[model samples]
Target chain A: MSRHRLTVVISQAAGKHPVKRALEEALVAALIMESGLDVSVIPSLYDLSPDHTGRLFLESVHGDMVVLSWLFPRAAFWLLDRDGIKGHLGETLLKPAADDDDDDGEPEAPRGIGAVDVPERHIYCIDLRDAATHDPFIDEVRRIAAECRTRREEKDRAASKPMMVELGTSLTANGTNGTNGVIGEHAATMPTFTAEQLLQAPGRRWYPVIDYSRCTNCMECIDFCLFGVYGVDGLERIAVENQDNCKRGCPACSRVCPEQAIMFPDYKTPAIAGAPVGAIGSLKIDLTRLFGGEAKDAVAQAVAERDRELVADGRDAVGMSVGIAKRQADKPQGPKDDLDNLMDALDSMDL
Target chain B: MGSVSEPLTFMMGKYPAVLPAELRYARNHMWCRAADGRARFGFSSYAVRLMQDVYFLDWQVNVGDVLEVKQSIGHIETSKAQSDLFAPIAGKLAVINEELLKDPSAINVDNHGTGWLFDMEHAEGGDAGTMSVQEYYQFLEANWENTQRILKGQI
Candidate 1:
C-alpha cells in the first residue's frame, strides 16, 4: 500500500524549449519512478480552462499536491484557484529569497479571488526554474509525503480520543455504536490517488497571465501587442484570446501596460515575472529610470521592441504611431546613487 | 586522473570532498568503503557540504534486513532540504550507526569517519553502477556549475 496520497503535477511550458522540456520530463521520471508519487504531466497552467482535461484532473485530486510549474509561484496559485483547484499555498524551501521589504520575507501568497465554497486542500507550487535538476524536487516531495503520512496517522489517533463513559444508569448498547469501550469513530479515509499514474500532457506552454487585480481596462496591452495575443471579450473587458499567438520571448506589451498588470511569470525579471509592481530591488525600476524620462522611456523602449519584432515579421515598424499614449511613471527608484541625485535635482520644480 | 589513489578532498580547495580511492560513490553523493565483503557506507564530504547543517536523520530499515539498490533505507532532514536515502548497493544490513543517529551533525563534522552511516555484508561482487573515487571527483567537477545554479535557484 502507498504511504500517503501525494501528487506531483508537472505544469509544462507552452513553447518547446529543449532545456525546459528536458527538465519537465526529468522531474516526471524521477518523481513517478522513484518518489512513490502519483505524477501528472499537464499542459500550461495559464492555458487550462475550467473544462480542460488537465483542469478536470486537478479538480479530482483530494490529497496534498505539489505543483512544479514554470510560472511564478503566486501566478501559478491564482491560475489554479481560478480553475477551481482551490488550496492554500504550501511552503517550499526551494525558492529565491524575498526582497528585504517582506519583513518576515515569507513568500507572498496571492489571496483567493473569491470565497471558496469547496473545502481547500494543500498545494505546494514550486517554480520549475528554482532547481537545475530534479534532486531538490524529489527531496521536497518526499518530505511533504512523509509529513502528510504523519498527519494522517495523528488524525487517526485523535479520532479515537473519546472513550465511552460507563455509567450504571446510562445508555442502551448498540453493537455498531462504539461498542468496544470507545465513543469516537475512526476517520474514514478520503478518496485519493491510491496508485501512481502519469497524466498525459500537450507538451507545449507559454502565455501572459493578466493580473486582473492590477489591470484597469485601459486597452493599452491590446493596442501595443503586435502579435494579436490580447483581445476583448463580450464585456469589452481585456482578454487573452489568442494565447498561442504570444511570442515566446516577447514581453513588449507587459512594458507597454500602464497598470504593470501583465505577468509573463517565466520571465527572469521580477516585476514582469509576477512580483508586485514597485517591489524593492526590482530591475524594472532601474530600467524605467535608466533614461530619466520615467514614463516616456519605458514606453519608447517597448514600442521600439515591438517595431523590431514587426520588422522581423517583415512588416513596417509601427513605432509610437500605434499604441501611442502617455504611460504612468514607474514608482520611485531604490536607494540613490550620484547619477540619481543629479537626475532628481534637475527634475525638481523651482518654487 | 592525477592519482586514482589520491583523496579528492586534497584538491577540493572549495568543491569539498574527501573521496579516498578505496571508496566507491553513488550519483546521489553517498560513499561506500568496502573491504573483505564487509562494507561500510556514509555520506561523502560533498553530500554533507551540500546539506550544510544537519538537523535530523532516521532509518526505515531495521538492522539485519536486506536492501536492494535504489530502495529507500532512511531519510535525513536539514534546514536546506530533506533528502531520502537510497541504497547504492544491494546488501544485507548489518551494523547501524547508533552514535551518529543520536547526533546527526556528526555527518557535517566527520562524515568519512565517525559519521559512517551503516554497515552491510556484500552482495557477492560489487555495485556495478557506482563510480570510483577518481571518477566521482570528475563527476563533481563537471556538475559544479549546474549545482551552483541549483543553489541559486536560477534557470
Candidate 2:
C-alpha cells in the first residue's frame, strides 16, 4: 500500500475561517474515501506571513506529499509574487516587483534560502475556496497523492534516507491526519514577527487604507473583500482590519468601490500610454470593456484592429486575420425550450 | 443582428488581452463565431490570461450530441482553478479540437485561433441568444470589478 503524507498550512485561525476548516476536513474525508491509501493530513497555522510559513515548510519533512493550501487566491498570489520566496524554490514564478509599493527601499533576501530541498521535494499551491464542490481540485489532489506515492516507492527501492523527520513535540491541538499523521508547529524558540513589523518589511506594502472623508458606508468593500482586509470597527464603520492579509499587486477592492474610497499606498497603478493611428480607438474599446460603456462595435473588431497593429509592429497578433468569421448574435431570440433541453441533458449527464 | 462584421478594436483596462468583435460571448467567458449555422467556440483571450497555466481540458459531450445554451460541455482545469465550459448557443455537437488533447497549453497560447474548444451545428430558429461582443464588453466592464474580487477571495 502507498502511504501519502499531506501537509496543509492554514494562514488564519480556524475559529475565524470556518470555510477553510470545512474544506480541510472535506479533503481529509475525500482522500481517505477516494484513494483508500494510508493518508495523513498535517495542519499548521501561519497567519499568511512569509517568516512563519516559509520557516515551517523548510524546517521539517512531514510526508510524501506537501500541499501549501490557502483559502484565498491572494494568499497564493503573495506566496508566489510579493513574498520573494520563489527564489528558494529554484524557480522565478513571479514577474518583476515594480508593481508593488514596498516600504523598505532596500531589496530583501529570499526566505528559506539554504533550507529548501527543491529537487528532493515538491510544493504546489491549492486554493481551497472551492475544495468542496470543484471535482477538478479533488482530482488534482488525488493525482498528486498518487504521484507522491509512486515517487516514495521509487525512492525506497533506491536506498534513500527517510524523508520525514519524526515529530518530537505533541501537535494534537492542530488537527488529525488519519489519527497518526504528525502535525508540525512553528519552533517555539523562533522569534515571531507582529503584523505591524510585517507591514513595514520590504515587499509587503499591498494592504488597503480607507479615506474617511470620501468614504460612503455602502458596505460593498466590506462584503466584497474575503481576506478580512475590511472590517467594521467599534463605531460600526468599515476599517482596515487585517492589513497583513492583503495580497500584493492586487488593487481590486479599490477598483470595485463605487465611491473610490479604498486606496493602496504601496501599489503604483500602471499608466496607460498613448497609441498611434488605429491603436487609440482600440484602447478606447478596451477601456469600455474594463470600465463599462456602449461601444460602436463588438470586441472582435477592436481585437482585429489591435491584431493588425501588432502584426504591423512585428509582434504576434491575437486573432485569425485570414478567415471570414461569422458575426455575433445581437439579441436574445428566446431560450425557454433550449433551457429545458439543457436541463434534461444535464440530468442525463449526471453533472 | 447588428453589424457583426464591423471592423473595430478595443482594450480592457491596461491588460493587453483583446476581445474579438466577431464572436458572440457567454457570461462564462467563452466566445463563439458562427458560420453556415455551425458555431465554433473558444475561451476569450482575457479569460485565457486569467487562467494562466492550463494543464487539462476535458470535454463531456461527443459529436452528434445536442446541447442547449448554458449547458456545460466541458471542463477546464487550470493551475489555479477549475471552470466549466458552457455552450454559447443551443446546437448539435459537431467536432472537438483533437490537437488540444495532446497539448493543453495551446488553450492559453493560441486561445483565439487553434485553441478553440469545439464546434456545433446551431439548431435552426433556436438561437442561443448569446451576447454580442459590444454587449459582452459592456457586461465585462460592469462585472470586471466584482469578478476580480471574487477571484481574489474577497467576496
Candidate 3:
C-alpha cells in the first residue's frame, strides 16, 4: 500500500467558530480511519493576521495533495495563485492531457485549480455540498494519488529542469490576478470612511456582518448592492467592501441574499431614539442613564448636551444614521441571523 | 450501551457527554456496532451534541455500494453547520436509516437507536485496540480535558 500524506486546510476566523471546529475534528478522524492515508489537518484562520495567508501558502506547498474545506477553498486557491504556483501547476497538469490516451467516457479531469486555468490534480474542494456521500471525493483522491505517482515517476526518469509558466498579461486583464483587487474605475476610488473611523460615530451603529458559517458565495448580495458596500474578495467570497457606503438601517441587499448570511447587530433597536426612554419630562431618569451621575445639576447638564447633539447633528449623521427613521417605518428589521430561525423552523416540523 | 436507543452518558459538562460501550468507535465520534455479521453506524451521542440542532441528513451513498472505511456516506446538517458522516469500516452498504432522514433531530435525541445512520455487511480492518469501547471512553476523556484547557486559554 502506498502511503499518501495529505494536508486538510480549514479556514476559521480568530474568534472560535464551533462549526469550523466540528468540521475539522470530523474530517481529521474520517481521513485517518477511512482513507487509511497519513493526514495532517492545518487550520488557516483568516484573522491570524499580519501574515495570515502567507503562513497558509508556506504550509500548503509541502503537501502532495491539499484538501480545502469550508472557507479554505477560496483562500487556498488565491494564495496559490498569488505565489505563481497556479500557472506552473496549470501547465504541468495540462501537459499530460495533451497526450491523453483515455478516450473512454470517464468524467473529464477537473479543471481550474488555484483560481487560475489550472487542472485540479493536487487540489480537492470539500464544502457543505460534499458533506453527504463523499465516495466520489475518495475516488478523486485516489485518482490524484495516481496522478502524483506518475508525475514522480516521470520527474525521476527525466530529471528535467522546472518550467516557469509566465501568467500572461491576459490573466491580469481578465481580473484573475486577485479577486479582492477592484476592477475598472473603483480601483482608484477610496471609501467615504474607514471602519475604524466609522466606529467613532455613535448614532451610526448598523451595518451588515457576514456569517462565514452560512455564506455560500452565491454573490447575490454583490449583485444587488447599488452602493459599493459589497465586493468579491480574492477568494471570490462576498466581503464588506466599503462599510461606509452601506446605507445605515437599509438592508435591501441583505434581503436579496439567498443564503441570509448578512446581519445587523442592533437590528431590534430603532436607529434613532424616539424622544427618550420614558415619560417626556422625566429629565432625572434620562440623566442617570446618560451621565452615570446622581448629581442633579450634572445629570441635567448631560441630558441638555445630549439632546442638543441629537437634535442638531444626530439626524444628519452620514455614517449609519442617515435614513434610519424612514427605514424603520418602511421596512422591518431585515433578516436577523437566520440560523436560529432555521433551527426553530426545523424543530417545529412534525418530522 | 443497552440497546440502539439507550446510550450511556458520561457528562463532563453540558457537552462532550455520552457513549455507547458496546459499539466500536471512530475518532470522529461515529460508532460502529457488529450484529449478525453486519456493522451498524451512527453518531455517538457526544458527536450529535457537538453538531447541535441537526435538522437535515443527506444520505449520499446508495445501498449495495462498496464502502471503504472513513468514506463519507452522508452528511448531517444543523442550521448553521454541516458535517460529513464517514463510514467506520469497509463493507457493502446494506441499509440506510430512512426514518432518521425524515427526522434528523432523532440523531440528537436518540442517536444510538433509531437514528442509526447506515448498516454495512463485511466490515473490515478495525482492531479491538484502537476502536473498542474502552479506547473510545479514553479518547473522550482526553478530548474533554483538552476542551477544558482550551476554554481556560491554557493552549
TM-score: which candidate is best?
1
Regions of candidate 3 where Cα sits further than 4 Å from its true position? A1-351, B1-8, B14-16, B125-130, B148-155
Q: Could you give candidate 1's per-residue lDDT for residues A1-351 as a string of tens digits? A: 124457778888877778899998888778866534667787778767555667766876656788988877767875675466777667776754423333332334433123244443478888887777878888888887787667656765777552323323323232231223332221112223222222344444567777655667788888778788888877776878887787776788888776667777766556677864444332212211111123234577688778878888899998878876654445555788543443444344110
Interface RMSD of each: 21.8, 16.0, 24.2
* TM-scores for chain B, listed for all candidates: 0.86, 0.85, 0.78
Instruction: Output the chain A TM-score of model 2.
Output: 0.34
User: Among these predicted structures, which one has the highest DockQ?
Assistant: 2
If scored against the real structure, what TM-score would every candidate get? 0.44, 0.33, 0.31
The window of 10 residues in a row where model 2 chain B has the poorest summed lDDT is B146-155
- What TM-score number comes out for model 1? 0.44
On lDDT, the leading prediction is 1
Task: Say which prediction, candidate 2 or candidate 3, comes out ahead on DockQ.
Answer: 2
Model 3 alpha-carbon miss at residue B6, Å: 12
Q: Model 3 reproduces what portion of true contacts?
A: 0.00
DockQ of 2: 0.02
Tell me the whole-model lDDT of each prediction, alpha carbons only: 0.66, 0.50, 0.47
Worst lDDT window (10 residues) for model 1 chain B? B146-155
Q: Write the per-residue lDDT of candidate 3 for residues B13-100, one digit (tens) a residue.
A: 8544767566787666778887787777787776665556777778779999997755656655564344556666678899988887
Backbone clash pairs for candidate 3 read A34-B69, A34-B70, A133-B74, A180-A234, B4-B112, B4-B113
CA RMSD of all predictions: 19.9, 21.2, 24.4
